[model samples]
Target: MGLPMPGDSLGDALAHAATLLLEASSVDDTLDAIVRSAAASVPGADHVGVTLAHADGRMEALAATSDLARELAAVQESIGEGPCTFDPDTAGIVHVPDLWHDERWPAFAEVAAQRGIRSKIGVRLYGDSASQAGLSIYSARPNGLDEESVQIADVFAAQAALAMGKARVIDELHDGLRTRQRIGIALGILMHRYSMSEERAFAFLTRASSHGNVKLRDVAAGVVADFVAGLEQPGGG
Candidate 1:
């Protein structure tokens, strides 16, 4: 999808963005598309980046539309203090009309000014209690983003959050399915070889997992591999 026309409504622009996100195939792809949409929807936004809070409390840029946006994100991560670093749930929307003189983030502001980013706006995206995230828009001109722009950005950020949340859920579901499949295959092997009941085979696998301090799935995988190796041995089977 492309940017809205001059007379197009912000709501319409946001709808288009949601469509693009829905068509995305993965988490990375969804984030990349959202950042691009932010640049298009927000007035005077020359660059955009998506910041993600990891489960470990580390923050990093997930995707950016330009090198400048990526560089700025890295700078903020290094300093550990910037609009993007703030918890969106509490801080709300953060708008810096003039980064060149913003006292709240002196070090970051100074460095950002050198890169021609005179203004910035960070809108919080959706995240769970374990993590948080936001979208950061960069502009080269002071007072580049106005109230209307900020409002539109909020809408875009919300849509991006929904898309990211769904993508993550899908990823988790796929991972869970694969883990179950591996464990089931290993259980079958154990049952066939040992003439044990399914419950007994599962119990054996669980004990092995606890004894080795490994995950149940990993233990299952190891059992399957060993069985395959035995079948391939000379004068074996």
Candidate 2:
């Protein structure tokens, strides 16, 4: 019933966690694994969560190991500041030895103190991507995130970033495959109805997409939908 812990060796832990990420069935599952790994493996981590900043500037923490972690992340999102707000792309790493006494993020520190969190650690994940994210761990005791803990958290964050990258790549591949399938079906429809060659059909779809200022995939989808609709019409093929 308990989650797996990281191995004694950091490399081994990273490899095992990477394998799990690759095997994750969905993006949610991969994120869940990252949080769980942090909570179980990282020293001084009583709870773990992930804060994701979308390209549209929306921030959210949908993957967390406990309610406390989720609440803390929500507070940061609402206030627009916290350990997870660190720009991993530029700032690299951040370690908060005592949130209750940390003056840098007063609003967040107040909220965290009220929630019984005394210390925290955040390592940016996928910092170079359009969607910035970080892995955060919270503790109820002051000075919990020491140097060793910070090092461990760094390794954990690195592994998490790798997993997130793999998950996104897999999602993009699936989307690409689906788009290709739709385009192929639309091409088939155009060829059968208009007696057009494959090259001509694709060109026509491209021209339509350019003229309409729409994505080729969307244009192809519309063609497929129209073809299907025609089939449902009375005395129509």
Candidate 3:
């Protein structure tokens, strides 16, 4: 089986690709869609790459069009000069177009040239809070990413980033006051029943997630579900 191709024109391609992102049921699905879109939309964009988590600590391309682009982006991310904060150039990472004229990434440039990549464009993925996740796009042609292509890529990046940012804020982040209040009630029960401290109770829940090989949020969700379930029962404590 082959992956779907969106369109011939860049705009049509992006519009089609946007449908995929919109249809995505999860964050990972949306990002994977973006990478595939970039590779397919622009002419000669043989490779595409993107960073995951886009947060401050670490940057990594979750999806890449080729092993070479992926490796280079990771190297730049590892060096810590790339777009941890979302720089427009190189998409907060490293990009090499005519490595002969550009030696920004000495080692990566060598590797890119050896890999036969002549031009590349990296548009950083940003969050609603304006944080960066990663960059995407790569090419084997010398003049692959022209102005129009870059603009189109930027539109794609902005749309995907906005969607992803919204999803993260809703899923991973919460209004702390509300979350703390809801969890505090549940934590209080655990502490009273098990003789644990505030911090210890939270750790116990965290460890339960680790022990069960699940997410802490999943554990918290279960706690809330059980609390709601208990309230429905007769004489529930």
Candidate 1 structure quality by residue, lDDT tens digits, 69-185: 888877877887778764535566889998876899898999999888899998878666776778899899999988888988887887788898889888889889989999999
Model 2 CA deviation exceeding 4 Å by range = 6-16, 54-57, 86-90, 129-131, 228-237
Measured by lDDT, the strongest candidate is 1
RMSD of each: 3.0, 3.2, 8.4
What tens-digit string does per-residue lDDT give for candidate 2 at 1-237?
Answer: 244464456566556666666677667888998888777777778999888766545678869989888888778778877777635355767788998778889999998998899988877776555667878888889998788888888877777777777788888899999999999999999999999999999999999999999999999999999988988999878
Ranking by lDDT: 1, 2, 3
84 in model 1: Cα distance from truth in Å?
1.4
TM-scores for candidates 1 onward, in order: 0.84, 0.82, 0.61
Model 1 scores worst on lDDT over the 10 consecutive residues at 83-92
Candidate 2's error at 224, in angstroms? 2.4
After TM-score superposition, the amount by which residue 25's alpha carbon in candidate 1 deviates from its true location, in angstroms, is 4.0
Off by over 4 Å in 3: 1-7, 52-57, 78-96, 127-131, 173-237
Give the C-alpha lDDT of model 1.
Answer: 0.84
User: By TM-score, how accurate is candidate 1?
Assistant: 0.84
Sorting all predicted structures by TM-score, with the top scorer first, yields: 1, 2, 3
